[model samples]
Target: MTNSISITKIRQLMTMISLILLTLSITSIAVRGFNWGLDFTGGVVADIQTKPDVTQVLLKSHLDSALSQDVQVTAAGNEGNWQLRFNDTDLDLREALNRALLPIDSNFQVTNSSVIGPQVGLEMVEQGGLAILACFVLTLLYLSYRFEWRLALGSIAALVYDILIVLGLFAVTHIEFNLTVLAALLAVMGYSLNDSIIISDRIREVFRAKPDGETDSLLDKSIVSTLSRTLVTSGTTLVTVSALWLLGGSALEGFAIALCVGILSGTWSSISIGTLLPRCVGLEPNHYKPEETESLQSMP
Candidate 1:
């Protein structure tokens, strides 16, 4: 009895915390919005090879002085290979590059230069939004088909919870919202859904195994049973993502950060929202039982 009460209390606390996070996420998105990156907004990108002695800071400083607007410089892949991005569409990139870079490298060369028009950016925004919407719809359909209505809804709620929290992290931090971060969001959805399904399956199994068990006690047992699996999966993924964040360079920084946040939030939502919502909606063992087949009355 004590254990059951404690578990119930923990669930309530976690639910409250999740609600606070969700509310904050929505509010931040509404007020602050996202920090759209060059990929989402029209901009100029140039790949250049700099002298061995030219560092990113040195190049950025020189470009900042030469160009009329701000320029962002990030290392591309190999040594002395750098990419530059700026929103000054009217500024002459070739002239600016020549003026600033020639003084330093003398042999610096511009390998590629391209412009992303506003129309293309807008189209990308529309398509990315549609992709996320489609993913949610498909997930909802699959979950509803695979489980009871209550469980399916709970799983969906958990997924939404994970996404909002991850998005909120980006919003609050003002991190660059680019294509890579968008990809991370989609990956988060898949990871969170997998975790939720595993817990839901365990819940159903526990309910069937002990039909008369108390709801809180049974749910507690189910969560406890899968806790190790969740930890191992999340832990290993985080390790790899952390490596990417540390060594993958500026290009992949946003992607790695998004994944890290998503993984942590996904784990939390799966353990709390995924299981608690179903219980709150009155999920019971009877919901999983086969329909009773009535015996035909004996002919009198």
Candidate 2:
């Protein structure tokens, strides 16, 4: 009993610490503009594999001298491989940098290098924003039809908050928001809403089951009853997502992390906010009568 209490106390403290850290991160990001990536801002990626002993600063120095333009170099992979992120949309600059850096190392080998054009990058940003917006609007319409308008509104609010929090995480972390990250964010929208809908359906059933239940109490009961299932489902999801996060490689890491965070938040809001919509509209779940559904029909 003592150990369990101690662990719980420790966990509570840890959670408080984490929230404080996140607050600090957001404040810092607000002070400093976002750390935009090459994908959104447009630039060239120069990935090179060289002799095992080559250093990034040396590579930067050599390339910087030869190209007559500045560049930021990131060392990736095992000791020999490196990735250079440069601020330019020039194919010629890419080729020149590759050619110049190759000779510096006895076994200098260019693995992959390319310039991402600004126009294409801008188009991707535009399309991604539109896709998210369209998904949100369409989901609202679908839930309104399948459930009730109030339910739809509640679920969408959670969805919007989930997405914003995810973006806020990204912004605060200063992670690279490439196209892959956008796809992950888009995926969160559907995944989050699906969880919300499940709870919404349950709330409707709860309202139906207890015809004389007060609306608030009924919602509370519905959420409390569904709590176990939500935790179990989210736990299972976290297992797989955590596995992916641990082993998904750099390509999928950002997306996986975003999904993991959003899923947990989605589950939380489904119980807390999603079920409270009817209560906010002055419906008492525990006191609900069978005609309560009809009452909602005339609510708007």
Mind giving the per-residue lDDT tens digits that candidate 2 earns over 205-261? 887787675555555556667778888888998899899989876557788888899
The worst-scoring run of ten residues by lDDT in candidate 1 lies at: 291-300
- 17-88: candidate 1 lDDT, tens digit per residue: 999999999999998999988888999999999877799888988899888667889888899999899887
- List CA RMSD, all candidates: 2.4, 6.9
Query: Count of backbone clashes for each model?
Result: 0, 17
Which regions of candidate 2 deviate over 4 angstroms?
A: 1-33, 46-85, 90-113, 284-300
lDDT, residue 95, model 1: 83
TM values, all candidates: 0.93, 0.72
- Candidate 2 displacement at residue 263 in angstroms: 1.4
C-alpha lDDT of candidate 1 relative to the true structure? 0.88
C-alpha lDDT values of all predictions: 0.88, 0.73
The TM-score obtained by model 2 is 0.72
TM-score of 1: 0.93
Error of 1 at 73 (Å): 2.5
